[model samples]
Target: MEETYLLNVEGVKKKILHGGQGELPKLQDGSKFTFHFQTLKDDFERTVIDDSREAGMPMEIIVGKMFKLEIWETLLSSMRIGEVAEFWCDAIHTGMYALVSRGMRRIAEGRDPLEGQKHRCGMGNMFDYHSTGYEDLDELQRTPQPLIFIMELFRVEDPSAYKRDTWAMSKEEKLAAVPVLHSEGNRLVLRREFAQAAAKYQEAVICLRNLQAKEKPWEDGWLKLESLVTPLVLNYCQCQLELGEYYEVLEHTTELLQKHNDNAKAYFKRAKAHAAVWNEREAREDFQRVAHLDPSMAAAVKKELKQLGERMRKKHVEDRKRYQGLFQSSQG
Candidate 1:
């Protein structure tokens, strides 16, 4: 007689060994099974599409999209009759229904769908996911899963006001009000507002450098300063270059190259500054340094250097001929 067994593999519910007259085997949660069984010659394997409509199965579906059951079929193909398999699915599978439900809730609350999705997906949270506050009508309707889980698990007092206040402040306001200047600097950099961001970065570097200078040479302070100053200096140079402040770019790049002679970006930026000031010799030197430090830049640097040299030689020849002609005319 043929037999069937309902198995709970991981969190997924599946039926194995269909068409049995005997009683089905019950596999409890976290139970392990490993067995080999022979199938009757007449029995044929059947394919079933498991979805939310299927009994004892919870699956997510959108009207137009392909069913995700194909993924489950591929995973199950390797399973032996008695082998117990355990696996995990990501947000695309496990959290799909929850995400859609939350989105629908936002719509019911008179919130824009796009705004609702962003908040539910935790897009606005840069630092701590829990501390990231939300604002507007949409954010007010949603709660982060982790936060809600924590509250439910521990039965903690509702900190609705506290949470609300946190999300109430926009990312811009939060960055500006951040106590650590460097964090605000980083936020600005991420937003591509480099000039305004450079100020905060410069201030942070200065503060750290001062601390390093005050402390003894062997102290941990200098190490911290080195970590902070290097990146900040690089960013400051880049910002100055972007804003067409070539002199400031040269100053920052010069200081950086002093400490890190092998830094390719510093050489490149310094070369740009030199080129801006019509200092071809200095620019060529820096460009050569960059090409040497990073072989990938060699072709571009060689091309620019060749062009610069040709322009300078042509200009020099023209100037010499013009001066010589003037001298001969005066002599005449």
Candidate 2:
């Protein structure tokens, strides 16, 4: 006969695989818990969905931090340091696991957790992408099911025991950090530190995004936050242009242009990127748009067009000569 201890929370049962020494730690707000976890399907095979140990890092959760998977916090709170326990959580508590895992996986892969969510909220992103780009995660998203989480608690730190990074900050804290980061980025740009400036600007954009995720998509509050993101992204793109990351510039500027068609600066930067990448027709079109949008840029556009014409003409001549030589050699 199998036995399980019903947790204080409903629809959850825990089984201690390995007991830990010492008393239970305080579970105050901001207390950080680091543990290794293996998420398994609650079936006969007990299929593993994710493992933090395999990822070479333990998972972490700060109490009362409003983590997407609230059940993890509850599960962790009931354990002592060095304890290993398995918790079977109902589908209601596990439904958001896929979304949470998607973010974690993206972090592990060194990608933006919000890569495909440039201008939308998290729910909007789920509706649009319809997949986490991972097979298991997508399956889980499609069919919500109960899950077994094997958690090995390792370390727990009090609220003031460690420094808090931006990701751990509250919404108000994040809002306060944005302007400071923006100014830092501007100062770095003034020093000609394009890479460092880009990082700062990108960080500020992320802070805004985190806050924006809480608001409804395209609503007044969300749009207000998005408005703040625009200038920071443009600044980041400017740094990319300086660093010769033309494709990155193109990608960001194109997204910006899609939303704000009248953005002359976006068009101008995109035109420069297109010219650098030898997208002649695209460059010309963007340059023309820039001129039309902001008549003050007419002289600059004219200069760019002259330079582009000269460069393309030289390239064409070189290509024709090379082909002619190849043709003659082949005939001989």
Q: Which candidate number has the best lDDT?
A: 2
- The clash tally of candidate 1 reads 7
Per-residue CA lDDT of model 2 for 220-253, tens digit only, reads 9999999999999999999999999999999999
TM-score per candidate, chains pooled: 0.38, 0.76
lDDT on C-alpha atoms for all candidate structures: 0.51, 0.90
Candidate achieving the largest TM-score: 2
Q: On residues 134-201, what C-alpha lDDT tens digit does candidate 1 reach at each position? A: 23212322422111100001011122312222123333433344346667877888898988888877
Clash count, one per candidate: 7, 0
Task: Please estimate how well model 1 matches the true structure, expressed as its whole-model Cα lDDT.
Answer: 0.51
Q: How accurate locally is residue 11 in candidate 1, as Cα lDDT from 0 to 100?
A: 36
Which 10-residue window of candidate 2 scores lowest in summed lDDT?
117-126
Error of 1 at 83 (Å): 84
